[model samples]
Structures are given as structure tokens and as C-alpha cells.
Target chain A: MPLISQQQKAVILMADDDADDRYLVQVAFEENDIQCELLFVEDGSEVFDFLMGQGKHEEKGSKIPNLILLDLNMPKKDGKQVLQEIKALPAYHHIPVVIFTTSKSPEDVRQLYKMGASSFISKPSSFDKLSEVVRNIGTYWVETTMLP
Target chain B: MRKQTLQFLYASLAAAVLLLLSIGVFTFRSLRSLIEQSDAIAHTNKVLFQTEEVISTMKDAEIGQRGFILTHDSSFLKPYVDATQYLGRQLKLVDSLTNFRPQVVQRQRVRRLFYFAQQRDAHIKQLLAASLEPNRPDYDLRLIALLNRGKATMDSARIVVDSLQQTEKLLLEERIHHKDQLSANTLGLFTLISLLAVLMFSLAFYLLIQEIRRRQNYERQLEKTVSDLLRTNQDLEQFTYVVSHHLQEPLRKLQTFSTRLVQKHAIELGDNARFLMERMGSTANQMQTLMADLLVYTGLGLHGDTTDFEVQDLAVVFQKTVENHEKQLSAAKAMVQFDKQSWPVLGEMEQLELLFSHLLQNSLKFVVENQRPHISVHTFVITGEQMPFATQSQHDERFVKIVFTDNGIGIDMQYQDKVFGLFQRLHTADNYPGTGVGLAVCKRIVKRHNGYIHLAATEVGAAFHIYLPLAN
Candidate 1:
């Protein structure tokens, strides 16, 4: 129940199909001075492989993520399906999932929340604002609250 | 028109048909009775003619008897014998004709007349036999007595025949009068039935034509409505596409590049250059928020799924709204109190949640600078009479009234009407941070649920009253 502490490195897994989005998010976190081990996947399928230690991620072993950031638009599999599959499994349900996408639709936000997303953050267009959003997330999720 | 109206028309048509059938039956019965009365009259007249024939035959027989009594000759006796033969055949014809008369008294009179004729014939024969007797010394007296008896019998027969004729004549007159009256009655009934049938037919035809016109008008109106809806849908789709793609995509690149310029080149650039980049980034960010809010506003204009509606608990919706604004509520030290046992309303849950969230956010955003906001939510059932605006035909429906009263800077009465207008804002961005579409979105959401939302006059902070139909 304690905060994630500066000594313990928190592993954050992010799944996005867009290379630009993945790079911008990494830069945003760096701008915010967030100290965490960030992992990346190109699509929803890779997210699953990373979580279950399957396919190319099998040699990496099962390293449970403290939080997962998912994008709604992806190839092969979408974020909604991955979120549903992750929530349906009792073994992976404890990992906090945050929906990070460009869509600010109320329906998408409501549906993601109903599907057990811990938070819904609209992907900011500006890196400065994205840095602020990332700083806030790190402060709230990593520095302020306990992660399972 | 409607199914019930059509059914009523069919029922009326059936009733009219039944009425016409009954009238036909009645008219036929009346005509038959009239014909029967005419037949009776004709029978009475025939009986009258047969009685006259019998009376005339008796007169001939009396004449022949007198002639034979006076002459005492065979030639005169020949006339008497022919009279007797003709009398038997005439009497038989009279008897058959009289049988057709309706009255028993006429039949009896005919029988008495036949008896008188037979008596007369017997007296004639007696008179002739006496005259033929040559040795009889009292022949003259017997002949004279027989002649007197024959005359008395013929007179009696004439009186009976006269009475029978008089009765037949009276019956004939009575029957004629009855037949005439029946004919007049039947004519009158036929006229009335024809008038009634014509009136019913006219009414039915008029109703059918009116119904057809009404249905045609309804179809035209429906077609117009459908076309208007299609056009509006096309406009909304275009708007959505532009907002999502063309509008946001460029703005996203603008903000991204502005932020990158400020982040990577801030050391090489002067203070003013860095400020411009920062301002560019902030402005792009503001525009993005505006576009997002606009998307939501326009999205509401899109036709919603009608099947998404269900009976939803207002308390649950309120809970979700509170949870969504938890951070803001805690930061402002705001308190939102409401009855836990709120009434259930018929609506889409997500839309209702958004509606409540906007209202709650309004209260949170428009508070006094140093004061903690206190928002009290009250719910109760209300009739149409309690509504501030005019209600048409929904007066009988029960509405769940939800009132959100806050202890913040209240809106002026003049601006209350404009608060729900799209993109209408009373405060500057520096004073209050909002896209000025929160209340408008709430209004759209409420309207989607067939409900109403309005700003009630308040002395302290803002008060919003939302009226939603209670689930029956």
C-alpha cells in the first residue's frame, strides 16, 4: 500500500501503433523528469506477448508491469480488445491500465472506464502539455498512490 | 388514418348494411300484406256477382211457375222444368263462390237463399201436378195456394240474396280502405328508408374521403420530416469528419511543433522568441480543447440509438459524476449532498452521467475565489404544473425533478436564458476555465432523454433544475 519509492524502479508498459506517438510519449516522460523503466510495444498483440511472455518476448521472462498505457487505434488488435482480455484474466487484473489515445469522445471514455481502465487521458497534441500530463500521472500513480 | 379509426369506419358500414337489410325485409312484408288484402277484396266481389246470378235465376223460376199455374198447359210447364234444371246448376256455382267469402254470416245467408229457391221449385212442381190432375175438383184452390207459396218463397230468397250482397259490398269497401292505407304506409316507409340509407351512405363516403385526405397529409408530413432528418444527418456527418480529421490533425501538428521548438531550441532563442513559442503552444492547446468540446456538442446532434434507453438510477449516475470530478472536488473542498434514495428515470445512463457531470462541474468552476463550494442535490417527483416552462400534452406524466443548488456566484436573471445557449459564456477564461459548452451539452443530453433542464432563479449560487420522466 506504500508509494512506489524512488529506490524501486517502476516498469510502465505502453502499447501504440504510431511510432510518432510512442516517441513523443517517451520524450514527454523525459521532459517531466519521471524516473521509471518504460517499455514499448508497436501494437496490441505485442502488448499481450509482452505480458504473457510469448513469441519474441518469451526470452524476456515474465516481468509484471506496474501500469499499462494503451492506445485505442492499433493494427491486428485494438486497445479495447486487449484491455478486455487483460481484465478478464485474474492474473493480470491487478495491473493498472490507463487509456492514452487521441480520441476525446465521451462514449470512448465511458466505455473504457466500464471496461476497467484506471484512467482515461486524452493524448495531448503539445509536448509541453503532454509533459504536464505525464508529470501529473507520475505524481498521482507513482509518487502519490500505491501500485499493485 | 389510425387502425382504431379504420375499425370504427368498418363497424359503421356494417351497421348501415344491417339497417338496409332490415328495411328491405319490412318493406317486403308490408307489400305482401297489401297484396293479400287486395285478393280478399276481389274474392268478395266475385261472391257478390254469384249472389246476383242466383237471385236472377230464382226470379226466372218464379215467373215460369206463375205462367204454368195460369195456363195449365205443357208449354208453360216446359218453361218451369227448364228453370228448375238451370236453378240447380246456378245454385252450385253460387255455393262455390260464397265459400270464398271470409265471413260465416255471408255463407249462412247463401245457404238460406239456396233453401228458399228449392222451396219455390217444389211449390212450382206441386202447382203443375195439380193442374195436370183432370178428376181433381179442388184444382183451382190448390193451384192458387201453390202459387202464393211460390211467391212468398221467392220473396224470401230475394231478401236473403240482398243481405248477402250488402255484406259483401261492405266487406269490399272495408278491404279497399285497408289496402289503400297499407299502400300509403308502405310508400311512406319506403321513402323514409331510402332517405336514411342515402344519408348513411353520404356520411360514410364523407368520412372515408376525410380519412383518406388526413392520411395523405400525414404521409406528406412524414416524408418531409424524413428528408429534413436526412439532410441534418449529412451535415452532422460532414461536421464530425472535419472536426475529427481536418481540424484536429493540423492543430495537433501545430501544438507538437510549437512544443518541440520551445523544448529543444529555448536556449538558442531569446526571451521574446521563447514566449511566442510558448504562446503558440498554449493557443494550439486551447484550440484543441475547443475542438474536442465542439465534437462532443455536434456528436449530441447525431441521432442516438433509441434502444439504448433503460430505467436508470439517478443516484448511480450521480455517483459516477462525483467520481469523475473527485480530484476537482477535493481540491476545491466542495461538498455535494443529495438523498441516497433518488428516483429512477428512463434514460441512457452514459448521457445522464455526462449531463450531471457538466452541471456539477459548472458549480465547481463558478465558485467564489476563497470559499469552499457547497452543492446540494435535491430530487422529488413533480407534475407538469410545477415546471417553469409550458408543457403541452405531458401534463399527466410524472417527472423526476432534480435540483442542483450551489453556494457559489449566482448567475444574473438576465443571463439565465443565455446560459444554456451553445458556446454562451458569461465569464472570461482567466476567471473561469471552461469551453462554455457544458450547460449546452447538458441541455442536449436532457433533450435526448425527453427531459428538460433550466436555470432556476437563485439568491446565492446557481440553481439548475432537471426534469426527467420517471420510469413507470
Candidate 2:
């Protein structure tokens, strides 16, 4: 499998309810110059709608996202519930899901992994670390593994 | 008193009672034994007197028989004749007087001897009075036959009677020995009883003294309780005076700062500054709530009012609280579910109203954004048939279970312990806004009424279980 450059990568889906947290993550990604189409949803409910080709993402031309960054705490449906729903569906089961949240609980990490999350990362407390994390995640996702 | 102290007091009192009972039993047993010894001594005396009478009758019969044979005189036969009748009477009397075996046997032997002597005297009188033929050999032969018959009979009877008399004497000696042994045993038993009585009495005395000391100690403890209460009263007074004086300074500062900020810095401040100022205002308000709750908590502990007031309808209080927070509930689009079973609880109506309102407000305030809020209220009564602690009982010290649940921004498991602390807050002021005094106030109120609160679970949302003890 040939490696795709960061610029060639398709959209990466992000789900989070906190506006400040989402803005901070976006700023970190831009500062690190980890280029890919970044698509965002406000919560797990919206994430499900986008994935299932319902609500605002019913157009078939919009490509399925290559990867997902999930936050655990959200309205309507939490990230843990979304992870469980996604893993249960055969079509979306192979798509890599990474848990990204402000919660540093070991219990949360254990639970997310148990639900078939690809990786779990605590949302970095400082901006500098968050920027570094964004760059590394981007490098690994875009330039390394072959997308299904 | 502590449970350990109460147990010690009960144990000491039981020991004292046991000691007294043991002494009483020992005294009763000793008196019974002394009466038994006196009865045994009286039995020994009767046996000895009957034996003596039998010996004297045997001696008189032997003397009279000897006098009649030696003198060949009818006048000498008088003692022998009288002896026979006397011996029969003595034997009958001895048999009636004593149960002793040897004495009765002796009396029978003496009667046999006395009868033999009388027959011999009759034969001698016949020989002396006869005036028939002078045939010497025949006469001598007759005399020999008569003499031998009388001698053999008398000798056999006398030997048996003497042996019997000796046997009776031996039995009398044995009876005296037995009496002495019984006396010794009684004395020993008496000494033992006395010793036991002394020991038991000593124990009782010691226990009595100990009881007195314990009673004194208990009195002292009561005195200490009174003194402690007095000291606690003094401390509370000092606390009220000092805390009131101290609290006024901070409150005055808060008011002064707010006034100054409004007058002088209102124009210079940005959005962040105004936001900080609003938070400051909330903190002051929270402190004021805390002080008022503390006052009520202290008052509840001090005053217990037993009144015959009927249980006020909880629905009224609920309506008033909902009306007060109607704006917030409407904004959140919250729903309230109440089980309207009238539960008559003994409590101050105002305090109960405050407790329920605070809980309801907490449920409404912490709802997840864009989610409709929900609250459920209900009453459950426990009967004696149900397992204890799990059941809520009426008019007993058993708890009235009140569970408040909400699907909100749930607290983490680690922060559960800190929820009821005076100023413990998990979220930053930028996110969820609270002064962290509400749970503390709830804790104080619950504790004042001898109730308890605990965070039941936080799996997806928060659940708080409050248990209030029902009054008997």
C-alpha cells in the first residue's frame, strides 16, 4: 500500500460538544500544519446522522471520513454510546475511531478500548502539548496506515 | 454514654446481683444442715437405754436360780419365780422401746433363761415334798434327770443371753462411734458452710462497695455531662459572638467593594471583569445562605419541640417551591414527577420545605444542555415485616428513604467524597456555576435531624439518596 501525503488525505470527522475545546483543537492542528479536511459535528447524535447518511449529510457525493476523533462527554448521546453503535455496525466497524476527551480517567480509557476504540488520548491540558499531539496524530493517520 | 460505657455498667450491676444471691443461698443451706445433725444425736440415746434394762433383768434371774439350788429352800425360789415374770415384761418393753437388733435378741434370751429356772424350782419342790418308798437308786436317778435337764436348759439359755448382752453392748459402742462420726461430719460441714458463707459475704461486701464506687462514678459522669453541656453552651455563645462579629467584616467588605466597583470601575471594566464581579456577587450570596443554614442546624440540635400539630400537606410546600423556581424550570423545560401519598413526618415544616426545594433546584440546574430535565419524588413506608435499614418505617427511628435522580453532567466517582465538604467544587466557574455550599448545607440540615445523605451512583447521571429518621 502506498503512503498518502497529508495534503492528499480525505476528511477526518471530529465529534465534541464543547466549543472552546473544539476551537482549541482546530487552532493546534492549524499551528502544526497537519493538513487534511477537518469535518466536525457537535455531538454523538450529529456524528451518527453524518455517518448513516441522514440529517444534513444525506448527499452520497460526500465521502465517508477516513478517521474519527471522539470526545466522551456530549449531549443527546455520549461518545462511549456512539463508539458502541459504530462498532456494532459492520460497514463502519473497520473505520479507525480514536477517543479524544478532557477526561483522564483510567476507567474511561479502559471502557473505550473495550468498546473497540483504536486509541484513547486525554485531551492535553496545555496548548503546546495539544499542538504536538495533533501533528503526531495527523502524521500517523494521513501518511502511515492504508485507509479502507 | 458511649455503648462501651453502658455495657460496662450493666456488667458490673449483674456481678453485684449475682454475688448477693450466692450469699443468700449459702446461708440457707447451712441452717438446714445443723437441724439434721441434732436429729441424728437423739436417735443414739434411745438405743443405749433399752440395752441397759435387758442386762439388769438377766442378772437378777441368774442370782435367784443359784440361791434356790444351793439352799434347797422354797423361800429362795421366790426371786426365781418373780424373775420369770419380770423378765417377760422387760423383753416386751425392750422390743417396743428400740429398733436395735442386738438389744431385742438379748431380751428374748433372758426370758428363756428365766422360764428354765422356774421349771427347775418346781422339780426341786416335788423331790423335797415326796413321802413314798425308800428306793435310793431310783430316787437318785430321778433327781439326776431332773437336775441335768434344769442345768442344761439354764446353762444354754444363760450362755445365749450373755452372748446376746455382749453383742448388744458391742452395738451400743458402735452406735456411740457412729454418733461421734456424725457429730464430726456435722462440725466439718458447719465449718465449711461458715467458711463459704464468709467468703460469699466477703464477695458480696466487695461487690456492694464496688457498686457504690460505680454508682459514684456514674454520678460523676452525669456531672461531667452537665458540665460538658455547660461548656458546650459557653463555646456556642462564644462561637456565635465571635463568628457574627468576624462575618460582618467580610460581608461589609463585599458590599463596599461592590458599591465601589459599581460607582468607580463600572465604566473601565471589560466583559471578563464584569463576569468576575458577577461571580463575586454569587459567592457572597452563597455565604449568606450558609450562615442562615448553620443557624438553623444549631437551633435544631438545641431545641426539640414535641407538638400535636398535624402533618402539613407536602403538596403545598412543593407548589410554593415550584412557583418560586418556575422561571428556571420553564427555561430548562424540566418535568417534575411526585408521588402524592401523604407521608406524615415529624419535623419543622419550614426546614422540610427548604430541604426539598434545594434538592429540586439541584436537579433542575445540572441538566445536560438541550435535554429536557426530569425529577421524581415519592414516599415509601416500611413495616416490621421488611428487612431493617432497607425499609422506611413510620413513627420509628427507621429512615424515610428519599431518592433524587437526574440525567445531567454527572460527577466523577473520585469527586464523590468531596461533594459534601464546605467548599469543595469539581468544575471551574467558567463551566458549571455553583458556590459549593448547597450540598454542605443539605448535609448540615440532614445531620441536625439525625438523617444521612449519600451519592448512590454516577454511572450515567447523578443519584442522591437521603434518609431521614422518623420520630416515634
A14-119: candidate 1 lDDT, tens digit per residue: 9998777778788878877776788999998898789889888999977789999998888899999999999999999999999998777777888999999999
Measured by DockQ, the strongest candidate is 1
DockQ of each candidate, alpha-carbon based: 0.42, 0.01
**In DockQ, how does model 2 score against the reference complex?**
0.01
lDDT of 2 by residue, B113-141 (tens): 45654554565455444313235658767
The lDDT of model 1 is 0.83
- What number of backbone clashes does candidate 2 have, counting pairs of residues 3 or more apart or in separate chains? 1
Q: Looking at model 1 chain B, which ten-residue stretch has the lowest summed lDDT?
A: B241-250
Off by over 4 Å in 1: A1-100, A104-122, A129-148, B1-33, B36-40, B49-138, B141-242, B267-278, B298-339, B346-351, B368-374, B383-397, B413-417
Cand. 1 TM to true fold: 0.59
lDDT of 1 by residue, B20-74 (tens): 9979899889978988998888888877887787777677766766676667655
DockQ of candidate 1 is 0.42
lDDT of 1 at B6: 75
Q: What's each prediction's clash count?
A: 0, 1
